[model samples]
Target chain A: MNKGLIIAIVLIVAVVLFMTQSDKKEVSEPAMTKAPPPVQVEPSPAEPAAPEVSLQEAFEMNRAMYGKGHSFAWNGEQHTTDHPEEIEASKEATQANAEALLASAMAKNAEVAKLGFEWKLTGDILKKAQQSIDQGNFQQALNLAAQAKYHARIGIEQYHYAQANWHLSVPE
Target chain B: MKIIKTLALNLAVASASQAALAADSGFDMQTVDPEADRIALQNYFKARFPETEIADYVNGIYAVDAGSREQWEELEEFPPYEFDVEKGEELFNTPFANGKGYADCFENGGIGIRHKYPYWNKDEGTVKTLEQEINECRTDNDEEPLAWGKGAIAQISAYMAWTSRDKVFDIQIPADDERAKAAYLDGKKFFYAKRGQLNLSCANCHVQGTNIRIRADLPSPQLGHVTHFPVFRSKWGALGTLHRRYSGCHKDSRSKPLKPQTETFRNLEYFQSYMSNGLVANGPGARK
Candidate 1:
């Protein structure tokens, strides 16, 4: 009876210890190893790679995101708009992509001007995005950079259309 | 020689076909009657706003919008253009170093002569505006010409407009001048041509969009619009010429404005003024 009682007590203590260690591991996890936090994502370099998506996630994300836009025609007039929200592989990737878009949009300055459109408003939005980045509004900044890109693209098309119309009309 | 003959035959056939199509649709401007255009244009305006008198058309938006007209009448009490008019009169009367003033450059000593502007200059073979004549006047007297859309030009034009007050527009496209007719047609084309990102034309706003609220603003009828010149716009915070207003319209439509007094603009003025041929000058007008 005494031996059985001692074994039961020992098993109970071991189980208690195991559970306590598990709880400790859960509590002490570095945020990087866990899922990403909501907005104001400041992903550190030390973040562990997400187990679900690995080698081809970036390409897959882009392929899926870039093709998500839709177009429709109403009353004989065709209308189109973009999907501003993108499904990025990671918050850091989203930031990096936004930076690239900003650079490319800025580089197309001459092309935009040639299309007879000025980018003053777009440029101002870009400045605001930079300010947002410095002020820790990374997600907002990304959205704004995307808006600027959209404006630049639309401006280019409008410029070309106006230029063609002028040429055809005035021929001067 | 055989190939040339075949090409010539094909070209002649193509020309005949095009001419036949034009004849069917009456699509050519070559023989358009300016007098007919004026009558039709005035009739259209009169038919639309039956209550407004023919002469009152020169008052522009005021002839349509009673509330805005009341405000304008009140503003006219102090008359926002008074200072500019005074400055312009001083400038007009001031002689150049050679003792020649603007009066020396024009017939009738530059007074009561604004109605005759934007006329076809037979020698120059181009349309000339009041602004152009002012510049010519200055240059002839060995003085520097003012920038076309600048405040100084507007001020001078304001004084000229005031001097010619109530003189009905007498724009004439001489019977024999095809060049003048072509210019007039081109101006009409410019007015009606859809342009810019907004896909707007001068006609779209002033004709079709008249009395339609565009975010709390109404476009006035195109008739008699040319009667007003060097208008004091609250938005501009200063006097602006008719071309300046036209340039604003261009910019508003997201199109780059051609420089003031370009052949395109002068021709545009020639046709626009001709449309309101008998409306008296109601210029140096003030507006929001």
Candidate 2:
């Protein structure tokens, strides 16, 4: 092609590409911000095959899995309490844990409840203080807020202690 | 009839070989001892680097203990003694134009970190994983956050995890605060939220019906998920931050991926890590 003709063609092509890109951006900008349509995907294949285990292998695997999980029931139950001694020990431990958790939870509930009451009291105090202040008693209101702040601090401490105890009772 | 029987015999042998071939992958179902998985990780490393002796300093923790003891001491810091820590330190101090540093947000020079992670934020009513915490600090400081896979966040997370060696994770998200309560609730929801092509939630395998097969084995819920972020995974063939792991889960779910440091993932990390409280911190762990 002649130089002038080639240059003219190149310029036209560049203009066309730029126009197309701008058009695409204009079309896409609004769609970008909108909520996307729900996507429907094809279902996946069935699960991969499990390890082929003989009966003995399956039993051993189950035993290991159960052990890792700390599932200690043994009477045809979850655990391997094949021995009478294990059963007795497990039961005793379970009972102890249950008692401890119950006691701890009760204590926690009481502490948290006390804090909740304190918070309520603080709110009431603040309201009364606000009324007093509106009536031009700044000193009384200030005193009331100080008391409310004290109550709030106490509530926080109580809540923290209760929660800590609760945490201690529950094993990870 | 004779030809048909011969063909049948050949087919049977071929099928047996194929079955054996299928079972030959590194992870096999019947032989799955967690011990075996541990050994596989070892063999994989040995095969990858024949010269190096990767030492097992702590239980369930592995590191390349090559060179003299003094030289290995230098290697203890991750990114193989690169500008990783320095860049991380600079990134740590270089306050994004928004005027913030790691010290401003977290405790312990931002060291002894990972303790307050995976926290339930009752205010935002969501769990905030450590990754989310980092992203929160990054964004709050007016910086475009680092990508999760193998960048600044991973570098910093790795560095912090190294600094926090042998420390037990002790997160404190005040449940009494309304925000903390909300965060815990949201985190719990995320834990139970099912997604992916498999339609599995973290709780599905980790909690309820654990030990069911995905491929070989899935670790149980109690195995300290948060304690192993910035993990050097065999599957990934590279070091990755928790958010990268999150993104992998999302991709596995076939869900639209959230941005690194997005709220949903941060909350997910919070709930996941909360489940792993009391486990000793073991970040940048080598895993399959």
Candidate 3:
């Protein structure tokens, strides 16, 4: 209650109030200020990504894996690839070559089926190939038979791949 | 340099421990451990849906989704499979041409023997399914065998499944028979192997993709998949055997479906049934 003490207290209170206000202003200053404008980045011009391999190219690559004289072996039976060369030599699709191709396809499909990895479309394709043969469309038949054979080969490959890698998918 | 050496030592130790842990937990393709696989699979679903009871897995998709469960419960009140069960019962009771009925062929008069199916026949050296056995019974009795996939075979299976309502799956892979173990392993391989143009395995949908919607359908967990057999699916609009469903799944995968009761399928059933060993049979089920 002394005059000097009261004056001193008032001055101290004012100082504290001033400091509190200053602290609040400092805390809120960042929020009140505008954020920096977003950076405008121009994407660098670059060459377009290379296109993926075409289906025909992929098919040719797959076919190349089985060399000219390759013999497909399954269940103790070996199916030689002389039919492709024979067809190529004939220059035109022949019933004999078509039948041979179908036989090879059937052999491969049987192997795949035994493994329980036969593709659903393979049988239908084989059937279509047979129908094409019946209709004397030997070229179409040859193509269909080759497609079926391709599917069967893929199925066999899938089976082996699965055998090797199935454990990788098993939940730990 | 000392810090780097210490860090390297820590890394090596950490990696060694990790490898040890992986070896302990990892499933061996060569090894046939049905119980271990079952436990791991069930645990997966349990961890995935902590709220769900293990026994409730028999409900299939209903166990995961509440919305579907409510609809299913409502459907169960007036079950669609009732007529098929009745038909199955009649067929099961009818005597063969030789005066021996299906009852004469089975243990316990075929009342509640659905859970013990896809057993390895040691003498025959093959996996024998209920459906296969039923046909065998017919042939033994001088009766013509029923067709494979649907119709009478499915009906009879449904009746047998109905009789086995609460019986838990108890498929056995005989420890003495290496062939039985091989069959199981083969089935396991088939289940895990990615097939067809889709390149998807059974585990991809049922195990990893459970409760995850694909288009309009929700793939159920694999834990209790075999519990419901000869199910009356809304898609089918009639009861169909488990093999029939297997064929459908194969078709969906764009893989050629093997004929019903093929050796491969029998093995698959053997593996699947073994996985559901602890889960109760709740077949002759109606599903959407």
Candidate 1 structure quality by residue, lDDT tens digits, B1-288: 665465446434533442332222111365466676677667766766898897888888899889889998999899899999999999888889999888888889889989888899878889999999899888887889998885888998899899999998898887677788888877876775655545566765676555655656778888888898879998888998888888888877655566788888898999899988988997889888
- List the DockQ of the predictions in order: 0.02, 0.01, 0.20
- Candidate 3 lDDT, tens digit per residue, B195-263? 886676787677666776665688888888888888999999988888999999999888998888988
lDDT, candidate 2, A1-172, per-residue tens: 7999999999999999999999997788886676677685554557543335544455466656664224443223354412221222233223343333233333433453443323334455656755655666555555554455444444556445533332211111
Candidate 2 on B214-265: residue-level lDDT in tens? 4443333323566766776657766688778777666554433556666666
Ranking by lDDT: 3, 1, 2
| DockQ top scorer | 3
Error of 1 at B228 (Å): 1.8
CA lDDT, every model vs. true structure: 0.73, 0.52, 0.81
Clashing pairs in 3: A120-B256
Q: Worst 10-residue stretch by lDDT in candidate 1 chain B?
A: B18-27
Off by over 4 Å in 2: A1-172, B1-101, B120-129, B133-142, B208-213, B216-222
**Of the candidates shown, which would achieve the greatest lDDT relative to the real structure?**
3
lDDT of 1 at B1: 69
Against the true structure, candidate 2 has what lDDT? 0.52
